[model samples]
Target: MHDAISYLLFLVGTFLAAGVVKGVTGMGLPTVAMGLLGTVMPPASAAAILVIPSFVTNVWQLFYGPSVAQLIRRFWPMMLGIILGTVGGAALLVRVDPVWSGCWLGVALMAYAGYALIAPAFSVPAALERRLSPLVGLITGVVTGATGVFVMPAVPYLGSLNMSREELVQALGLSFTTSTIALAAGLFAHGAFQVSQLGTSAMAIVPALIGMWAGQYVRMRISPKRFRQCFLFFLIALGLELASRPLL
Candidate 1:
């Protein structure tokens, strides 16, 4: 049917755009995809579509970095917390109305956009990282499970660690990968992840990969700082748009 074709086209386009953002800025695929797709689909369904692409892309990003073992050893507590929180939050997602989820998603996007605009540069003391990492991880995981957007206190917390650019990117990949996997598991447990959805999610990887390649090419030619500012502004607009949906 025409409607089916149109929906597929939209899915491809959404993932492609999301992939480009991730490739250029090292994050935002799920956030962007969920924000756009949730307009047409349930939040739970949008989250289902994200599982495979997010996992694959983030794993690629994770292995691209050095010292994986060291990072794992350093961040295990946080990882564990993410798992626990996602399991709990996914239960909440299943119980809540989809409209409420959309509203939460909108608020989350707006908050993250506001933070990105401010762009603070700060560092956590070494002692604090050990104490706070799990807490941040738990919060990010709950957000991820409920809204399918996982970059909250976690990203900012990682940024606060004052890592080199490459390390930061790799660390983010690790965190995202963990979140994606946990989210998938949560969805599966809740019976929201149907086999057909898995197939669709797998197919989505191709467009995402293609867009990532294209975005990398663009990244080579432009100032990332400028591009990021533009992207943040766009996200602000998107957040506003999504937020207005329930109100209107």
Candidate 2:
């Protein structure tokens, strides 16, 4: 009984912290949640619990933008590609040994951290966006499926689209929402995610929201850029530890 309570506490704390990171950094909820939870549970279970909180938080981010219709019309191919890639890889995610999946997830975290830290400057020509977006989505989908971390080629690709700051945030929301929904669908289809688990997932939102609120408040007082740098560095350390867990 105590063990169950401890587990629940730890789970709540993980989401809460992840939420705070998102509020401050404008991202990292899934990556942080998955990284921490992967320490205590298999990647599949971590991902299953991640579905609801991720979807709910990203929804508000998705709808508040002025160019939803325009973004959707432009990125539909990428969205479809994410769904297809997730469906294709769901079986692998569930069937593989947890050790390898954890390693992949860790690698993904490191890659994302590296890319985000560098914040490299480049852009896809408008002429190439139509062709490159789907490819980027497909690769992002594979990464998302294998590790359940949704940032990658997708975020960088989106960054390269030459959007304004506000559009970029909303665009990120759209991308994350699509990934979350695809992930849930893939899990449901594979029977890795069950109805019974959803209650706890729903409950998790309370802490996540609270943490996000706290983070937003903190954001008003702190340097978000510095916070994000620290956060990314933390992800690198966490990723290294996770990747090395099996070897150790």
Q: Quick one: best lDDT, which candidate?
A: 2
Q: What tens-digit string does per-residue lDDT give for candidate 1 at 135-186?
A: 9889988998888889988888999998888888888888999999999899
In the predicted model 2, the residue pairs found to clash are: none
Query: What's the residue-level lDDT of 92 in candidate 1?
Result: 67
Q: Model 2, range 17-42, lDDT digits (tens) per residue? A: 99999899788899999999999898
Superposed model 1: Cα runs more than 4 Å off: none
Using Cα atoms with residue i matched to residue i, what is each candidate's TM-score against the true structure?
Answer: 0.97, 0.98
Q: Give the best candidate by TM-score.
A: 2
Clash number by candidate, in order: 0, 0
Query: What lDDT would candidate 2 get against the real structure?
Result: 0.90
